[model samples]
Target: MRSLLFGVIAITILGLTSCQESAKKTPEFYKDTVTFDLLSDMKSLLDENADKITIDDVNNLNGAIRYYSPIKDSLIGKTIGELIEGQKQRTLSTNINLTQATAFSTLFTQSLKFNISEFQKIEQENGQPLNVPTYQFQNISGKSIVKLSGVVDYYNGEQLIKRFTIEIDKEIPADKTLNQPYPYNHDAKNQRDVFVRDNFDKLRKVWIPTMIEFADGKIYKRNPDKKGENQLDKDAK
Candidate 1:
């Protein structure tokens, strides 16, 4: 009876030891990996709720680590929950101001209109006729436009042929139109016309307002598109 009791106690001790060892073992995926490779693997393992990993997902993860150096030590051996908690803590530590820039931009764009009113022909010093384009900006926002800057994309049908910068520092009052000559010379205008004529079937242009400043000292900037082509905001028409 004494021998049987001793044998049972030994077996119990051995079983407990085996369980502890199993708990101490590192997961196979985490061993001998660091940096982006480790982050990529971690993201794949952690995001089980996702249907599948996407290129954007990978790119965003990579971007997160790109600016921070020596992140390998910080990320290794951390679980998904731990990583998320750390991110939240970091965000709380940082100071940032969220403003109503987008809302203001939407309002301004909805109230403004742009068009090429006409082309005026002028005789140059060399007795050559030069065609200059005129632009019209109509403000119906019930507020004056204090300052504006953006780009105009000239397209032939659906194809973009030329781009020009537009800047206005003076005040354009509510319910009024501001007519001005194209900021560029006749040579530039002729160049654009020729380029469009040779490359495409139809000529059209879109005004893409990038930044605007109002009288109250608030500013708005349009968000850039990732594909390098900016579209006219639907609200602006």
Candidate 2:
């Protein structure tokens, strides 16, 4: 009887030890993963919710232009023949190319929040319509990201739309310069860089709606005033 009792106790101790070892434990370093749930009110633009919001309440850049649909579109009596060669071509090149009226956009975001910080105002002007002062913060997750509330323009050449983009105010880890995409030809490389830079700039045109709120009080929305290409320009020197 005494031997049996000792054997049972030993088995119980071993089982408990095995149970502890079997449970998976997260690495200590994982404690530093940022966990702030703070995010922009994205549904404002998605939900079929009626258009109670004004032109400024939300960005209108998405689906602004259907890309690469038309080839050549000309006005009446202004066919390519008279516009190009002196001869009056017989049949119309129905290929009249007209710019589409919509485009698409996607924004990657990083959420950020903190225990305390100073109040800041929102403003938009010139080509870059964004200004949010950096505020100090302490987070429980130990990972800190900058809070930047901004908007970008969605455009394809002549077509333009406004997309509201919110970010943690840090360069994306995987972001690469547009000019770095694989290529060998010299002239092609130059043209490719131009295309990439234009695309990048088109990603920066943001429109400030009538009113928005932040750490401060009510704020006014503003869009960049510009002519020329009628688009934003972004390229690193």
Candidate 3:
């Protein structure tokens, strides 16, 4: 079965190391899996909205693409500017003019997507120090905070199917000098591409496995056979 990886974006987008002593992952935790029952749960949503706006729904894409100097490369006229066709230093902004467009109001009644655990531990990059995003979601919600910078896997019975991973560090929440209250960053989205369908497709393929290292120091491979296999088979047939 294909997953939409609802929370998979915006977090786990970066890679790093060593902010704390590695904690041993619980054997059962490795057992507690991350699975999406979207076909069953989200069917209504897809049915209602999937067709209303297909990828071709994109009408026009407008934005500025700019190139800037690195933190160290300020002067030298290397400061950078608007991008040219194939400039050594460039930022390209191609406007996509589609025939149709989709509206945001459609999701009001259709929110079908997998959840991440909130009381659940958010996976920090292997070793980056913790910083507050200044935003807050009730850690108690058990809503999964999808790891943006990771790989996601799809399983069917005992079979491991197709997979891919992408980093969302660019979207990962950063530590803030100030903190906001709950539901602050939840559902926050910024449009990048003309059709978000392409972005969603990329996210669905990533395997955002939970971070539960064993006492022996090996990583946990999220096995879907135990629970999600039934759903996989149901969807497949």
Candidate 4:
């Protein structure tokens, strides 16, 4: 009887020891493995949620254009093409782009709250034992800028082990008035007002395409011709 009791106790101790060792070997976070693809996961998350938020700064720009009332959109049937083009240039000016991207990032992360519970569906699809989420932005401007807030999660399979909060802010331009919705240089009845109302759709057209191209890593050294050829014809003068 004494021998049997001792044997039972030894078995129990070995079982407990085995469980402890297993726990140790199991990674608590996905980052423990070098095989993790953090960037891809983050890109997925951002792409999935890109359109969910109606960005206020963008809305403000739209509002400014809307407030100007009805616009003819063309000067004597020639299309106020120059004015439309100018607005696009100013709207996407390098400085303004940086500022807008910074503001957007700040707003997006604030709303996201860095909550892991919100990402359960994503984790399951990606495989789990999630590490913290993270992200990187390529072109931090234009319509595709909407996809810049990449909240990435690491996953082993269906189990969330870890999550990282993606946070980024670009430097605002030194010029305080660069991207202001209302420019002091222009009055209520100014060319700025006229241009916006006339070219409301134009803004979306010119702005969105450039950004989409940039996001896709398509950089145009110069404007392409009808055949989409960038190289100029050497035979031509």
Candidate 5:
């Protein structure tokens, strides 16, 4: 099927590392497989509010957008208004807009576009010592309206942290054959643009973590605050 997602955004997957000695002691919570059936939820939501609501009906539609920081000479942060303003002001070139816009509400009701789970482990960082394994879902389809991307966070030797989805892109071609789940016309001028910017941090804070199961038979349940920030040693537990 031609994916509802118009384009594929490639995220660099880090190479695999040998299962460390600490990894051998992986927690019992992560021993079993867990899955978050977002497709089912999306379907339920669509069915419940069929012909009734748009993306505006729901609340807390958290998301972010990548933009180049002229001062730093790099793409440093995600902000919708800043990005738009930068483009409008001619300070940033329009050729740089990589992905479209995504709203969290519309993302919750779509099916994944393609197979994307070959690698899931993220290498340990400085402050966050434990290697984190993540499950991701991208380029969803359904209703032919909105597409979304997803990530599920899991600790190396503990439980999960967050399972959330974000919008894929702002602009979607008008499909008269397809049902428009959201009231807005995605093809309209600046209609799909972000209304409020600078909410990326707020989105992270307000996002409620959920449980998820991977096809590989590993289950993950959210364990918020189990380990303090910058706590690294897995054996100390």
Candidate 6:
């Protein structure tokens, strides 16, 4: 009887540990993967409308496209005029203008720009030196951003050194400057300084906004796979 009780207790503990490990491996959200067929359709529409559409128009359409089965099927072979009309009709019926939603997202993203001002060495309460990076975000889009999340890739000359995801849930008012420190702190000032100095040239392109949320509850998300050459650039030609 004593041996059986001990065995059951050990099994229960191992089961709980296994469950916790499995939970940790699960992601908070899955990637919104775009299909190759959808990409081909988007390219087809752009090629068909090359002479008729502006870059902004293309951007709006790119933002408006959805990967869901029904919507994706409907947009497979649409002309420029057909695309615009469809967007309008869908907006009227669903009360959601994907194009407009995308436009707002683009506006908010383009409005905010960031630059690392300097690296400071501060003494902590424990009398240890901490190296913190001072950075500034300038919002010029005349609209406030409620939340923003993205990946910041730090490069040394041409080689990638560090990549980290940054999230700001606080309200950032339009035409205002927000000064904040990088979330990471280093113990060695010399190492931090060397990394910063090497990555200065690529600083401007470091911030790639993956998602943006406005005060009105509209959210915009960028496809992770399409990093440097986004749909706009691919379709513009």
Task: Choose the strongest candidate by TM-score.
Answer: 1
lDDT of 1 by residue, 49-105 (tens): 353334443454354444344654665554433444354455444422123344544
lDDT of 5 by residue, 1-237 (tens): 345333332211211223344344433321222123422254564456444433322221111112232335232332323333344444223222211112222223232332223322222343322222122333233223233223333222343333334333332322222111211111212321121111212222222222222233222232333321111123321
Best by lDDT: 1
Superposed by TM-score, candidate 4 places the C-alpha of residue 119 at a distance from the truth, in angstroms, of: 55
True lDDT of residue 68, candidate 1:
43
**Sorted by TM-score, highest first, which candidate order results?**
1, 6, 5, 2, 3, 4
Residue pairs in clash, model 1: none
* lDDT winner between candidates 1 and 6: 1
**Lowest-sum lDDT 10-residue window in model 3:** 96-105
Q: How big is the RMSD of model 5?
A: 32.1
The segments of candidate 3 whose C-alpha lies over 4 angstroms from its true place after superposition are: 1-147, 172-207, 210-237
Each prediction's Cα lDDT score? 0.61, 0.29, 0.25, 0.33, 0.28, 0.60
**What is the per-residue lDDT of model 2 for residues 1-237, given as tens digits with 9 covering 90 to 100?**
999999999999999998766543322321222112211322432254333323322232121111111423222233212222222121122112111101101011112222112212333353332223232222222232222334334456645532434333332122221111111122323544334344543432333222122222222222323211112122211
Model 5: per-residue Cα lDDT at residue 220: 27
RMSD to truth, every model: 12.7, 28.3, 31.2, 30.2, 32.1, 25.4
lDDT of 4 by residue, 25-81 (tens): 522221221112522353453345445322443343234334332654322222122
Per-model TM against the reference: 0.47, 0.16, 0.16, 0.16, 0.16, 0.44
Q: Any runs in candidate 6 off by more than 4 Å, and if so which?
A: 1-109, 125-128, 187-205, 228-237
Those runs of model 2 whose alpha carbons end farther than 4 Å from true positions after fitting are 1-150, 161-164, 167-206, 209-211, 214-216, 219-237
Runs in model 4 with CA error above 4 Å?
A: 26-37, 42-237
Write the residue-wise lDDT of candidate 3 on 1-237 in tens digits. 124453343233321112121222212221222123421343453346543423322111001112222334322222112111123222121211111111111111121122322211123565432212222212121222223223334334344443434333221122211123111111113232112222333332322432222222222223322222111111211
Backbone clash total for model 3 is 22
